[model samples]
Target: MRLFGTPTSLKRMVPRGLLGRSLLILVVPLVVLQVVTSVVFYERHWDTVMRRLASGLAGDIAATLSLLHRYPDPDGQAWVTDFAQEHFELQLDFKAGEVLPNDEHFRDALSEELNDSQNENMEDVLAQSLSERLHRPVMVDMAIFARDIDIYVQRSDGILHITAPRKRLFSSTTYIFVLWMAGTAMLLFGIATIFMSNQVRSIRRLAVSADGFGKGRDLPPIKVEGAREVRQAAQAFNLMRERIQRQVAQRTEMLAGVSHDLRTPLTRMKLQLAMMGDSPDACDLSEDVAEMERMVEGYLAFARGEGTESASDVDLVEVLETVVARFQRDERCAVELIGLYTASGERRQAPTTVRRDSIERCLSNLIGNACRYGQRVRVHYIAQEDEESCSIVVEDNGPGIPPVLREDVFRPFFRADSSRNSQTGGTGLGLTIARDAARVHGGDILLDDSQEMGGLRVTLHLPL
Candidate 1:
């Protein structure tokens, strides 16, 4: 239900988490792409790089041993060891038995003791353990044929036949590639955030401007920006607003002219009727003139209030109470005040204030119309359960309005078959005036078949 020409609903389709939603849409895909690409590259290429580096180190160690064998020279072996250490921190360990030489210094320190017969048995035990653990042949620190020479790589794991180096022979270009991919992803994410923000901001501006226009303010024309669709929508809204404003202005002018023209004849008729001398028909003439004047005035009032008015904050509950009170006073009808309501889980009162005077008049008209048409009128003032609005229901137990006439009852100069020619006279403008007032407040009046009373029920709803 509405006050006069108001929409009963105020809802928007856009979700509250629009920005977060957009960011998620953008960010999730980028992250997934990076993860997938990195995994695939690591498996297909990175493992191969590690294996090649291991093989190259093995080959380098083999060549060094061969060179030492050819020269039987400590200087050459030392030179090769120094070169390997400088490049990849390779430590040359000669595994004799379980007791491997720790380094060159340890080898020299224990040489004499190592040559004893008892030490030879200890060496045999070490060599047996080293041969089994290394899973391959190993060289001992002795003349190539004099002692089993085992050059085992020294590492966290006791000794391995294969050499371990500090760094792998992986391409520097691969690191650069990964960094570039990360940089590109971040850049895209930033660009997407910017674009989405701009789009949403444009929509926000459009919404604000529309709100201004709805309030009857002359909002500055919106500048189209952002995505093409959004810009187009803004342009369309501007054009539509202009068109609506022009139509409203034209309608106002037409109503003003028509009302003026109608009143001229009514005025003329009243003046002529007043000029008549005192007679039996004079009373009838005055009544007819009065009714006509009332109708014309009502039409003008309804049109003016509904079209030109702007809404303001109105305490809808208070407005209903006031209107119902006035109705009770004027017609001496009993009105019931139902419970006050709070909306959205808040204890605070919900007040819907808009065009106050217009809404009051509309309520009065509806209630008064009911009183005239029905006996035992029950006027109820209750806030709507829905958080969006409040309601006023005026119900009566009379011979209800016919279904055929219900739709047309709100038009100006329209009266039901049970009303227009009745002994109880009316100007046939009550419902029209009420509906107009409803529209002005951004609400509406609805006629329903009263289930409890088995008569007419008129409901008025105004938004909070």
Candidate 2:
């Protein structure tokens, strides 16, 4: 029910980048101005100039014919020709006792289609003026001469032929005007492109810096450049990044203090329990102390996962193999290490820049959970080089998480009834910590049902 398909479709047709749209904004008006100027010049200035030049030439030829009629003698005719030639720059020739040809014969013999619209218009104007003044047949042949025009005028006794310089009827200013207009437009457009690109470059650098920071990659402060608004934005971004970093540092310090304060009492209680006799109550209290220690460890690990670890180029395959081998050594669960493969079925190593410790911890948490819940664990590495990303799929052959509760399990300290039960003995922060680490590297962890393994499929996707 819309003339255009939709607003979204129209938006797709427009340039998505700022540089391209800015150039478009600059070019559209310039082209419209040029077109309007050219049209005005052609319709008013060009037409008026050609008409006046043709009329002037026609008046001179008319005067020559009148002088010839009055004298009639060859001596007087030669004199009139000399006078007209000296004054009007028209070369005249008179053929006595020769009849002018009919319109059909004249067109067949001398008429030609002129390529230039200006020349054609000039020919029409000159031919009209000559016919009106002489009241006789006039044939204008513009193509007969390269630098001159041949005009045939019917006289009382014969046909009069007049050859006039083509420059007299044509103005060179039109070409000069068009050339200057086009050249000026091109030069201005080039200058605009250069200036716009420089402005856009500042914005581009700001964007890259922001993205790197978001991905947990360390980058220097963005240099404020370009227009006032862009520089303001860059300054604001730098301030925001500093504020976030300060807040994170403060949080980490507070957590460190809290861990020390809690662990001291827990350690003292453990010492007391060990010193006491092996009573059931003492054993329960010890187990409770151990669980508290694990909860504290989990909290500290979550905080440390987002620590100030600079990114470096590391082989993802090697890290994945190492984690799989460590789990394989446990021998409690079946761990299968699948080599990295591209979509083309070729094995290749994935080398990407990421925080090595964060990525290793994320992988360890995922594998450890799989081993705890499932009997068989399969780690499949898929490298998508073209997309600049790689995916590590950790699948298990245990009672898979229900699709409805899959997302809930990722919440901190949240557990599902079926698989993430208390008997499994988890602090319920494993998936939360793993996902946080993945996101810090500009990646994500997705949970779904494993079709092949008939259990949970945890895919950790990271950008290269």
Candidate 3:
């Protein structure tokens, strides 16, 4: 079940791997936190600080205006400027019989880099505070200076212009706050990346080991690391591997011992039959001994086919060609080779890594069964490189097994030929051994009715 986005398209937009999803989980929340913090500061803290500073600056301007109005003489204006500079730390310039033009011009091109909604909000608060304090319309430009602010206040006869540092209405603490927040978030994300990469690396190694084991290949040892659960899973997989190997070994040994033990009595019986060779009873006993030997050999072969061989790169087309060439040598039945295919329905020239001996044994068994039962057999091979899957299909124009007994054909010693005819020469174990071989390579063989041949169609599917 998916717990993230509801829609399938939305889920597709999400990353498929653990590390990508984990990074998304980390970064999205950090981005939201940063955005929320910025909004709160602009809405509450930034506006409050700007309003207080503007009010203080407004009082300073009012005092300067009062001094300028009280002393209208030139000498008095000069004295007022000196007093204001000493008290307010503002550079004030006064001109009589002159006025700052009421142009009311404003620079509207805000810096896209530094200007945002919060910056505009602070500008509005400062403008409102100064307009109330001065009791007249005033134009204040903040962007004209990076470290200072300019104030234009009109006097009765002229204009009073003051240039003050930006500290009067803006806060430097804002820069420090944002810088620290970004630095902290980056450090956290860096740590998360390192941790997630380590965790994912462990999982990747585990997957490689599991895949190798499935393909009947020898895998390098897996070192348990990462989270506790991952380590536990690795340990469990290792334990399961040990149990499977032990079971295979036990079965192989038991089958070998049983076959050896039974062969001794059979060898004695064959010797006894040789003594009475001329009689019909001796000939019938010899036939029984031969059939018993065949059954024993079939059982042992089936028991030993748990893929003791390692997987290797083999050209599937070459493998099919070799199998077809072998069957072509036999004159009893006509074996035809259909085309080999890839997932794109194109001919493939690349080698597929697989258990060559096991796959060959599987193909030979299936084809052998097909030719043994049918007068004509066909082999078709398909490899889907992109999907990492391959299939070998064998069909025959023989009398197909009844549909009800199709699945039962794979059971040991359960032959469709219940009469056990010498012509068939089967111990009812060929398909079982073929299936075992296919499964050892992480593949399977299935039986179905052939629509074209009106007979049996066997498909072998393997994942690369």
Candidate 4:
């Protein structure tokens, strides 16, 4: 997520791409469940609240009607008027057959109920509740029934009345239902997007960092957080990376020490050999000592990873050309450079730049091996079918090596038949060093049958 600095953060969110896939498995179903739950919960809650509100409203209306009927005196009327004024709007119109005695107190009570509340119709809520209770459509509007009681509304100077024998009150269910639904949905969505994205992102970071570590890149140590399981995974990955790095460092140091110590004996041997002189066999002994020196130097250089860190941009074409030229100078070996060009048909193009000296050494080892074991050798530098890398192929015309021995050829100090044959020089470290160099450059060399040349084919590939 850090955008401006190193590529450390810009690496893909998951190492194997499965972390994002796993998150999708977890989150997609959860989101769907939440949505379904929200809808079902809202509807169920609305029904329960609406039913309760309807019962309360019906009871209140019946109780108010009873209080009005029983208390027909002025004090009673005054109390009724006070109740209506505080709670709702109502009207009382005495029928001729059921007349109330005309009194100032009763008149004041009637007047109070008339002037109490703002006159907006509650017909819609009442009708909806009625419809739900009856399980059939019901319409309520401003109207008066029997003249004894007038339940009506007046707005904008227009009197609207509702007079039903069975009174109804407005249900409060709609307010509660809407509020609950809106709140639940907002909460669910917020938790799903923000909280889940963060959890999934942390997991993705851990996976990607593990991948980068495997590929020999330094990933920032994972800082574990979030849910318990995710944190555990991150912590485990960090520990594994540290362990592997330490082991690799130890191995590299051990190799460095071994290479350094070998040089001291080699130096001493050189001095001892230089002193041998004035004999008929001295010339042959000196040549043998010189060969021993070359072998020792090669072993030391190969063991040290060529005295360089695993980095450097090598011009691959120059490496191939230089190796071929070196063998060309050795007229005893017939080395031919085949069509070694980029896929783009650019004659002077090199497909990759890697550790220069290491790549050159790898090429030289392959060509030298071919010359020693086969009659003719040809080297090719070109792109492969995948179009993402370059391959170097060294093939020859002699009888090919057995398939079983091909794999063994890359082992350090592994010679095919016996101790340094006439076909191969001293110290069987050539293929091992070559393979290691290719690996350090994020490439590899593979041995196969040379179908065209009827011998061994060694292909070295490096990433673009």
Give the count of colliding residue pairs in each prediction.
30, 0, 0, 4
* Model 4 misplaced stretches (Cα beyond 4 Å): 1-19, 34-278, 314-318, 338-344, 347-354, 382-388, 418-422
The candidate, 2 or 4, that scores higher on TM-score is 2
lDDT of 2: 0.86
- Ten-residue segment with the worst summed lDDT in candidate 3? 107-116
**Stronger candidate by TM-score (2 vs 3):** 2
The TM-score leader among the candidates is 2
Q: What is the C-alpha RMSD of each candidate to the true structure, in Å?
A: 12.8, 4.5, 5.5, 13.5
Per-prediction TM-score to the true structure, in the order listed: 0.64, 0.82, 0.78, 0.54
Write model 1 residue lDDT over 20-75, tens digit each, in one string.
67887788888998899988787656655644554554466655555545654678
In order, the Cα lDDT scores of the candidates are 0.65, 0.86, 0.78, 0.63
- The true-versus-predicted C-alpha distance at residue 33 of model 1, in Å, is 4.7
Stretches of candidate 1 exceeding 4 Å from the true structure: 1-36, 54-87, 90-182, 215-218, 224-236, 250-279, 341-348, 351-353, 374-394, 397-406, 411-429, 436-442, 452-454
TM-score winner between 3 and 4, please give it: 3
List model 2 lDDT by residue over 1-464, tens digit each.
76568988878877999999999999999999999999889888988888888889999999988898888788998899898899989898877788766655343212343343554566677877777777777887887458998888876778788999998987889889989999999999999999999999999999999889988888889999999999999999999999988888898888889888998999999999999979999999999999999989998887766756888888888888888889999978999988565558876777888888888899999999988889999998886748588899999987878888888888888865665546587889999999999998889999998999998899999988
lDDT of 1: 0.65
Q: Model 4, 285-326: lDDT tens per residue?
A: 777777877786776666566433444455667767877998
The model with the greater TM-score, 1 or 3, is: 3
C-alpha positional error of residue 15 in candidate 1 after TM-score superposition, expressed in Å: 6.1
Considering lDDT, which of the candidate structures 2 and 4 is the better prediction for this target? 2
In terms of lDDT, the poorest run of 10 residues in model 2 is: 105-114
Candidate 3 local lDDT, 95-199, one digit each (tens): 556655545353222211223355465455555666666676555666754776766666566656687777777678888888999999999999999999999
Q: On a 0 to 100 scale, what is the lDDT of residue 231 in model 4?
A: 95
